[model samples]
Target: MRIVHLADLHLGFRAYHRLTDRGINRREADVFAAFREALDRTAALQPDAVLVAGDVFHVPRPSNYALVQSQAELLRFRQKCAAPVVMIAGNHESVRSADNRCILELLTAVPGVQVVTENPEAVTLANGQVRVVGLPHNSLSRLNTIDLRPDPQVPYNVLMLHGTVDSSRINDYGGYDVPADLLELPWDYVACGHYHTYTHLGRHAYYAGAIERTSNNIWQEATEAKGFVLFDLVSHQAHFQTLHKPRPTLDLPTVDAFGKDVAALNQELAANVAAADITDKLVRQKILNLPKSQQARLDARQIRQWQTQAVHYLLDARPPTATLSEAIAPDIAASQGLTATVAEYLRQRELPKDLDRLHFVERGLAYLAQTEES
Candidate 1:
C-alpha cells in the first residue's frame, strides 16, 4: 500500500514584516500556498493513506482566517483524493491546561480525516490492512507515564509520533522525548516529526521535514530539500518528492572592519551588497571587528536604502575588542551589550556535531532582537 508521510506543516507561521497583496502576512501566505501545493500533489498521487505526524499549525491558538483556510483545503483533499488522512498534534498544537482545548480538535469535523490529539491511540485504515499507532505531543509527565509499545495484534503497523528521540540533541523549542530504544519497537514503519529536516533513522523510520521554511535557521535548512515522503508499505521503502522551491537566502561572508575608515567600510559594504542578487531574497551581511567610533560614523541612511531593496535584510555589526589596558579592567569587558555578549558566548561553546552552530547562534540572536524590539 502507498502511504504519504508529511509533518511540520506550520500553517500559520509568520516571519519578517512583509504583507501580501491580500493584506495577509507574506510568510503566512507562503506557508499556506506550500500546503495547498502539497495537497494538490497528494491528490494526484492517489495514495491509500496520508499520514501527517505533527505541528499542523504554528500555534495552538491560530487566527480564525488560518482555521477557515485550513479547513477548506482539508475538505478539498477529502473530496479529491477520497483517501484517509491521519494527523497528530505536535508541541505547537499542544495545550498545557485541560481546560484549554487544542485547535487540532476542530479538524475532527472534516470528513475522511482523523485527528489524534492524545497519545497511545490506534487507528485502522484501508479495511484493517494498516494499523497506525499515534503518539501526539504531550507533557513530559504524560510521555513518561504512557505505554509506547506497538500493538501485537497487527503485523503491518506504523508508529506515528511527534517528539525527540535522541536526548543529546534537544531543541530550544519544547518537545517530549522518548528513549532511542523506542525506534527498535516492532513496527513496519515509524514516522517522526518535531525536527524540521528530513532524516532516515533506519530502513523504515523517517522524518518528512517541514513543507516550507518556518524558523530562523532558514538559511541552513535552505540547503536541504523541503518536501514529503511517499512510503510504500508493501516494499518497505520511501521516496522523497520536493513540494516547492524554497525562498532564496544568502548569508554573505563576514567582513573585517579593523582600521578601515567610514568611507572605506561603506565602500566595502556597498560593493558586497551590489555583487549579490538580493532583490527578492532574504539576505544577511555581517561586519566584524569594527570599533564603536566607526559604527557611530557609519551612514545610517545608506544602510536603510540597501535594506529597502531586498525582501528582508539583516545587517549585523560587531565591535572590536578593547586595548590591553582596557582588557585589564573587568568592567570594560562586561560593558558589551547583552545581545553582543550572548552571540560571543555562543560562538565560544562546543555544540553537538549534528547541530549547526551558525544556525543556533542565529536563532539566539533573532530571539534577542525580538526581545529588544518588544
Candidate 2:
C-alpha cells in the first residue's frame, strides 16, 4: 500500500509585513500556495492513504479565509482521491480548554477525512489492510501518561503523532518530548510532525517537515530539504518529495565592528550590501561588537533604506557587552518612569519585522498606564 505522509502546513502563518496584490499577507498566501501544491501532487500520486501527522494550522483560531481555504483544499483532495486522509492536532492547533473544540475536528465534515484531536486513538482503514494508531497533541501531563503500543494482529501498523523525539536535532517548540523508545515500537512505520525540519529517526520513523519555512530559524532550516515523505507499506521504503521552492533567505557573514568609527562601519556595511545579492530576498546583516556610542553615530536613515533593496532586511547590531550593561544599569538604578522603561524594554526585545516597534511600545505603555490607574 502506498501512503503519503505530510505535516506542518502552518496555513495562515504571516510574516515580514509583506502584502500580496490582493492585500493578503504575502507569507500567508505563500503558505497556502505551498499546501495547495502539495495537495495537487498528492492527488497525482494517488496513494492508498494520506497521513497528516499534525499542525495543520499555524494557530488554533485561524482567520476565516484560512479556514475556508483549508476546507476547500481538503474537499478537493476528497474528490480526487479514493484513499482515507487521517489527521491529528499538533501543538499549534491543540486547545488547552476542553470547552473549546479543536479546529481539526471541523475537517471531519469532509468525506474520507478522519481527525484525532483530544487523545490517543487507534483507527483501522482499508478493511483492516492498515491499522494506524494516532496520538494527537495534548497537555504534557497527558502525553506522558498515555500508553502507546502497536497491534500485533495487523500486518501493516503505522504510528502517527506530533511531538519532539528525545535528543532529536529539531527544536521542540515547547511541545511534549516523545521518548525515543516509542519509535522503537514494533510498528511498520512511524510518522511524526511538530518539528518543522524533515528528519529520519531510523528505517521506520520520519518527520516530513514543513512545506514552507515558518520560523526565525529559517537560516538554518534553509540548509535542510523541506517536503513530505511517501512511504510504501509493501516495500517498507520511504521517499521524500520536495513540494515547493522556498523564498530566498540570506544570512550575511558577521562583521567585526570593533574599533571602527560609524563612518567606516557604514562604508563597510554599504559595500557588503552592494556586493552581496539580496534582491527580493530576506536578508540579515549582523554587526558585532560595536559600542553604543559608535552605533548611535551610524546613519539610521541610510541603513533603513536597505529594506528597499531586499524583500526584507534586518540589521542586527550587537553592542559591546559592557556598553549594553552600562546602558541598562541607569534605567534600573534610576527606576525610569513606566513609559520610559517599557520603551527601553521594547527597544531591546527581538521582534519580527512585520511588527511596528513604535506602535508596539505605545500600546504597551498605554496598557501599563491603565494598569497603574486601576
Candidate 3:
C-alpha cells in the first residue's frame, strides 16, 4: 500500500501581474501545471491512497474559473490515479462564522473524494484494512478535548490535517496559535499542512509544504528541489520526489546611493540588470537605496512602460529626502499640491502599495523636515 502526501497547492494564487504571451498570468499557470504534473506522476506511481493537508486555495472564495479548474484536476487524480483522496480545510478555507459552510465539504459530493471540514471523523477502508483520522482547522477549544486517539489494534492508521504544530512559531498566513502536542494521537504517521515550507516537526509528523513557490515574498524560502512526497507503506517511509518547474528568477545587486556618485551608480545598475541572465525567465529587479538625484535622472515615461513589460516584479528602495516643495513649505501655505507631491513620493518609491504606504510616507516627511531643521 502506497500513499502520496501533498499540501498547500494554493491554486488561483497570482503575483506580480506579468501575463504570458497568451495573456494569462504566468505564475498562476505555472502553479496549475505543477499540480497537473504531480497528479500524472502519482498515477504512474500507483499510490494506494492520496492525502492533501490544506490551503488548497489562496483565498476562501476563489474565482469560479479557479474552482472549475481545481475540480477538473481532482477528477483527473481520481480517474488516472485510481486512489482515494483525503483532504481537510486549512485556515484560509475555514470559515469563522457558523452561518457559513466550508467549500471543502462541497467536494464530498464529488465521487471518489472524502473531505473532512466540520468535525474529527474517522474512516476505515474495509478492502485495504486502513483507517484514516482527519482533523480540520477549527477552534482549538473544539479539538483540545476531542478524543483523537486511534485504536492501537488497527493494522494501519494515518492522521491527515491542516493546522500549525505545537512549536512557538506563528502561522505565516493567519496568526492563529496551534499547540504541537496535537499529535498526541496514536497513529502511524501524522501528515500536516498550513506552512508553505516543507519541514518535519517530530518523528512521523511532517509538513508536505506548498507544491510550488507562491509569491516573490516566499521565493527566498523555497527549496531548490520542488514537489510532493511518496509514502511507501511497505517500507513505512516517505520519500520526496523532485518535480521540475521552469521559471526564471533574477537577483539584483544592491546599490549604496548615499555613498556612490551618479555616473558610478548608473554604470553599476546597467551592469547588474544586464548580467542578471533573465532573458529566458520571469524577471524581478530589486533596486536598493536609490537617491533623489537618481530618481530625477530616470525617464519617467520609460519607467512607467517598464511596469507593464515582461518584468514581473520590482522593488525600489529610496531614502526619504526633502523635495523642492518641502524645502520651502512655509511659502507654499498648505496648497493642495502638497498632497500630490506626497502621493508621487510614495508611489515612485515602490512601497508596500497598501494603507501602510501612505502612513509611512506621512510619518517619514514629518521626521525628515524636523531633522533638517535641527
Candidate 4:
C-alpha cells in the first residue's frame, strides 16, 4: 500500500501581521497554499490512503475563509483522488468542553474521509488490507485504557496520532511526553504531528510535519525540512516530499554589537541584509550584547526601510550585562524566557482537574527550546 502521511496543516494560522492584496493574512495564505499543493501532488501520486496525523486547523474555530477554503479544497481532492483520508483533532483543535464538537468532525461529510475527534478508533480500509488506528489528542490522555496492539490479520497496521513521544532528543519539547512504548508498537507505519519539524522516530514511525512553517517558532524550523511523508508499505520506505516555494523564514547570522556604536551597527546590519535574499521573507537578525545606549540611537528610518524589504523583519538588539537579573526580558522572550511566562499563563487559564500542569509544561518545553527562541 502506498500512503501519503501529512500533518499540521494549521489552516487559518496567522502571524507577523502580513497581508496580501486580497487582505488575507500572508502566513495564512501560505498555509492554504501548502494544503492545496500537498493535495494536488498527493492526487498525482494516487496513493492508496492519506494519513493526516493532526492539527489540520490552527484552532477549533477557524475563520470563514479557512472553512470555505477547506471545504473547496477537500472537495477538489476527492474529485482528483480516490484514496481514503483519515484525520484527527490535534491539541490546537481539541477543546475542553465536551458539549462542543471537534472541527474535524465536519470533514466527515466529504466522501472517502474519516475524522477522529475525541477518541481512538481503528479503521480498516483498502478492502481490509490496511488498518489505521487513529488516536486524537484527547484520546492520548487515556492511552492506558485503549488497545495499542495491531490487528494481526491486517497486512498493514498504521498508527496515526497527534502529540509528542519521549525520545533521546525529547528535551527540546512541545507536547506531552507520550510513553516511548507508544512508538515501540509493531505498526507498519506510525504517523504523528504537533511538532512542526518532520521527524523520524523509528523505522516505521514518522512525523510528516507542518507543510509550511506555522508558529512563532518558524525561525528555529528554518533549517529543518518541511513536507509530507510518502510511505510505500510494500518497499518499507518513507520518502520526504518537498513543497514548492514555501515562504522563506530565515534566521540570518547574528552580528556582534558588543562595543559597536550606532554607526558601526548600521554598517553591520546593512551587510547582513544585503548578503541574504530577504525579499518577501520573514527575517530576523540579532546583534548580541548590544549596549543599551546604542539601541536608542539606531536609525529608525533606515531600519524601517529594511523592514519593508521582508514580509516581516525583526532586529533583536539584546542589552549587555549590567542588571541584577542576567535574563533579558524573560517573560515571553529568551532574556526572562518563554517557559515561565507560558507556565504562568497556563496557571491563570482553566485546566482540567486531572491535568498535571507542571509536567505538561516541562515536557513541551523540552522540544520547544529547539523549535522556539525564548
Candidate 5:
C-alpha cells in the first residue's frame, strides 16, 4: 500500500500586496493551485490512500472564493483520483467549532474524502488495509481526558495529528508541547502538521509542511525542495518528492550602513535590487543594520516604488539598538516604533508651530467630548 502525505495547504491566504493584480490576493490562488497540482500528481502516482495531516485553510472561515476553490479541488480528487483522501482540522481551521462543520460535513458527502475535526476518530479502510487514528487541533488539552488510544490488535496503525512537537523548537508558531511519549505509541507512522518546514521526529514521526510559500517569513527554507511525502506501506519507507511550485526570494548583499547618508544607501539598495535574480521568486529582500538616520530619509512612495520594482517583500534586517533609536527622527520612530510612541509624543509636548495646532487640540479634546451639539 502507498500513501501520499500532504499537510498545511492554507488555501485562501492572500499576500504580496504588489504581486496581486486581479484585486484578489495572490497567495490565495497560489495555495489553491498548489493543492490542485498535488492532487494531479497523486492521481498519476496512483497511491492507495492520501493523508492530509491538517490546516487545509488559512482561516477558520475562509472566503467564498477559497471555499469554492477548495470544494472544486476535493471534488476533483474524489471523481478523478484512484486514492481516498483523509484530512483533519489544524489550529487555523479549529478556531471555532462551528467553522469545522461546513467543510467537514460537506466532505462527508464526497465518496473518496474523509475529514475529522473537533474530536479524535479512528477510520479503518478495509480495502486499502489502513487504520488511521486522527487527532485534530485544540484536542491536545483533552488528550489525557480522552480514551482514544489505538487498539494493540490492529497490525498497521497510522497516527495523523496537527500540533507543535514538544521539543526545543516548540516556542515557534502553532507549536505545542505534546508529551514526547506520544510518538512512543504502537503506531507504525505518525504524520503531523502546522509547522511549515518538512521535519521528522525520530523515525516514524514526520511533518509534510505547507504546500507552498504561504507567508514571506517561510521564504528562506522555501527552496526547490517543497511539497508532500510519499510513504510506501509495504516497504515502510517514506520519500519526500519535490513540488514544482516556485517562490521568489532575494538576498541583498550585506553592507555596513552605520554612518551612510541617504544617497549612499539608496545607491547600494538600487544596485542590490538590480543585481537580484527574481524572475519567479517572491522577492523577499533583506538589508541588515541600516543606519536609522538614512532609513528616516526614505519617502513612503519611494519605498513602495522600490518594493514594486524589486521584490514582493522589503524588510530591514537591522538589530534593534539604542544608537539606532536615537538616530531616527522622533516623529518617524513614533509611528513605526515597537512601543506606543504616538501616545507618548502627544503627552510630552505641544504641537510644533509648522503643524496645525487646531487639529491636534480637536483630537485631544474629542477624547473627553461627550455632549451633543445643538
Candidate 6:
C-alpha cells in the first residue's frame, strides 16, 4: 500500500509582523499556500491512504480562516484522490480539561477523513490491506496502558504517533519523548511527527517534516528541507516530496568587530548586504564583540535602507561591556519561549479539574509575546 505521510502542518501559525493585503498574517498565508501544494501533490500521487501525524493546528482554537481553508483543501483532496486520510491530534491541539473536547475531532465532518484525537484506534483501510494505529499525543504520554501490537490479520501495519522519537530533531523543551526501545517493535512502518525536520529514525520509521517555517529561530532549520514523506510499504521505499519554496529566511554569517572603527564596520555592513540576495526575505546579521563607540556611531539611515530591502532585518550588534546574563538572556528566552515555559509548568503543576489549562496557558503566552513587543 502507498501512502503520503504529512505532519506539523501548523495551520494558523504566524511569525514576524508582516500581513497580507487582505489583513491576514503573511506567514499564516504562506503556511496555507504550502498546504495547498502538498494536497495537490498528494492528489497527483493517488495514494491509498493519507496519514497526518499531528500538530494540524498551531493552537487548540485555530482562526476561522485556518479552519475554513483546511476544510476546503482537505475535502478537495478527498474528492480528487479518493483516498482515506487519518489525522491525529498533537500537543498543540490537545486540551487538558476533561470537560472540553479536542478541536481536531471536528475534522471528521469531512467525509473520508478519520480523526484520532483522544484514544488509540486501529483504522483498517483498503479492505484490510493496511492497519494504521493512531497513537495521539496524550495517549503517547501514557504509553504503558496502550496495546501497541500490530494486527496480525493485516498485510501492512503503519504505526502513527505525534511525539518525538529518539532523534536529534527532538526539541530541547516540551517534547513527548518516545523511547528508543519502542521503535524496535516488529511493525511494517512507523510514521512519526512533532519533530519539524524530516528524519529516518530506522529502517521502518520516518518523520515527514513540517510544510513551512513556523519558528522564530528560522535560521536553526536553514539546512533542513520542508516537505512530506511518500512511502510505498509494499516496495519499502520512503520518498520525501519537497514543496515549493515558501518565504526565504536567512541567517547571514557573523562579523567580528574586535578592532574595526565605525567607518570600517559600516563599510563591512554595506558590503555584506550588497553580497547577499535578501530581497523580501527575513534576514539577520550579527556583529560580535562590537565596540561601544563604534556601535553608537553606526549610521542609522544606512541600516534603515538595508531594512527596506528585506521583509525584516535584525541588526544584532552586541557590546563587550555587557554582563554575562545580559549576553545570554535572549538566547535563553528564545530556546524556551513563554509558550514552552507554560507547557512545562503545566506538566509539573497540580491543576484544578475545572480549569481549562490549554486556554489559560495559550492566552497568557499570547499576551506575554505582545507585551514583549510593546
Question: RMSD of each candidate?
Answer: 10.3, 10.4, 9.7, 11.5, 9.5, 13.1
Writing each residue's lDDT as its tens digit, candidate 6 over 70-174 gives 899888877898889999989888888889888887788899999998888899998989999998888887887776888787899889998878656665245
State the lDDT of candidate 2 residue by residue for 91-171, as single tens digits: 998999869999988888889999988878888988898999988878434766777787788889999988887555565
Query: Candidate 1 on 62-170: residue-level lDDT in tens?
Result: 9998999999999988889988999999999888887888899898789988988865688999998899988888733476676777667765799898988766544
lDDT of 3: 0.69
Model 4 clash tally, residue pairs: 14
lDDT of 3 by residue, 5-108 (tens): 88888888877667778776777878888888888888899887888887777777877767888888888777776788888777777788889888876666
lDDT of model 6 at position 358: 82
- Regions more than 4 Å wrong, model 3: 21-23, 126-128, 139-141, 166-171, 184-186, 280-283, 299-311, 318-374
lDDT of model number 5: 0.70
Model 5: worst 10 consecutive residues (lDDT sum): 342-351
- What's each prediction's TM-score? 0.81, 0.81, 0.76, 0.84, 0.78, 0.82
Instruction: Evaluate residue 240 in candidate 5 and report its C-alpha lDDT on the 0 to 100 scale.
Output: 87
Considering every candidate listed, which one attains the maximal TM-score?
4
Error of 4 at 62 (Å): 0.9
TM-score of 4: 0.84
- Give Cα distance to truth, residue 106, candidate 6, Å: 2.0
Tell me the lDDT of model 5 at 9.
88
Evaluated against the true structure, the overall lDDT of model 6 is: 0.82
- lDDT values for all models: 0.81, 0.82, 0.69, 0.81, 0.70, 0.82
Show the lowest summed lDDT stretch of 10 residues, model 4: 320-329
Model 5 residue runs over 4 Å out of place are 19-22, 97-102, 126-128, 170-175, 222-224, 298-306, 317-374
